[model samples]
Target: MTPPLALDIDGTLTTPSGRIDPRVFELLPDWDAPVVFATGKAFPYPVALAHFLGRPEFVIAENGGVAYVDGETAVLGDPTAPRAVVEAFRERGGEVGWGDGDTVNRWRETEVALSLDADEALLREVAAAADGDVTVVDTGYAYHVKSPAASKGKALERVADALGIATEAFVAIGDSENDASTFAVAGESYAVANADATAREAADVVLDEAYMDGTETVLAALRERGE
Candidate 1:
């Protein structure tokens, strides 16, 4: 049987040039096993991606602050924790930079995500000193301000339980520090060749090819073995 897949978007499934490869949208739905899109993106992004891809809406989003499985959504973490930190960041002259009517966060439920264009260094400094247990993660494409109560590792266990599969049955693929948590909990994990140091260290295998090329290689091998 094919092992279930937990995949990260952005740098993992995208081309080296950062566009979502059409091949990925094709391959994911064809996989015989379940596929969960895990990411620092908000819930709607993955839900929408799965719908458009005709894949299952098993998603771990907002860096695990929110998850959707079997059509029901479970929310974790303190929604206000990161909001407060962002406010502090702005107070300290850190502009969110997304400007008015920011659509990226309009649908988010449990945390604040800033564009990489935002001041990463200032945001981290502010989040670290903020009250509560929130933290910042750099996902290459963006920066997320999220609560410690939420993490992809912790959320993956929930996904496993609801699917009636062990976390060890899932193979995680990703390319950022945000994906490190899921890598820790998965039975096997692959870091794309362009993966950040944190994800590389956490993964069981580091691929030779970069981006979606790496993903296709891994998927091809798994399907060949029928596991």
Candidate 2:
């Protein structure tokens, strides 16, 4: 069997607008291997996507703060990190806005999603205030304040162990800085054309196409290799 494929959701499988093109869904059925989703997204989003794919294999959420597999969910990091980071930010007079109403954000366990107006200084200040207790990761959509222990690479390792597969037997594809961990631990790492510079640098393969097209390209290559 071909090694599993671990994918990042936003900006990899979806458009910039965060919508999964129907064409991408059309390509899913052809890939005959475990498809694990590793994303900065919270809980239900990953679970829902797995259901849609008809592959409830494994999901790494909140950049690996949470993992779901085989009808079981596990929290891999300190769940209190988000609250501590938020409080520290507030104490420093930083005005933070939560993605409270958003369905996915509302379900987050180990991280808090906050939107900023490209205020890099404020982000740095918040990180400093945490004193290395937590980490602030920018997912392009929002800043995820989470524990330093959380990592997509670690989560992927857990999934690999659960599936009785070697850690180096998976193809990881992603498009952002948070995906750096996924790329680091993957046997083969791929980045779409639209991937951020950091992600592209970490990947072994950078596709010419973006979004769903890039994903399909990787899947096609995998199929060809297997044949």
lDDT of 1 by residue, 2-104 (tens): 8999999989888878778999877887888889899888888888889999988999999999888997889987878789889989898888778899887
> Model 2, which residues run further than 4 Å from truth?
91-93, 98-104
User: Which candidate number would show the highest lDDT if scored against the true structure?
Assistant: 1
True-vs-predicted CA distance for residue 107, candidate 1, Å: 0.9
* Superposed model 1: Cα runs more than 4 Å off: none
How far residue 79's Cα lies from its native spot in candidate 2, in Å, is: 2.7
Cand. 2 TM to true fold: 0.92
Q: lDDT by residue for model 2 over 35-133, one digit each (tens)?
A: 888999887887888788777658999999998777778899786757776776777677566534656467888887777553557766767766788
Clashing residue pairs in candidate 1, if any?
Answer: none
How does model 2 fare in lDDT? Answer: 0.82
lDDT by candidate, in order shown: 0.88, 0.82
TM-score per prediction, in order, is 0.96, 0.92
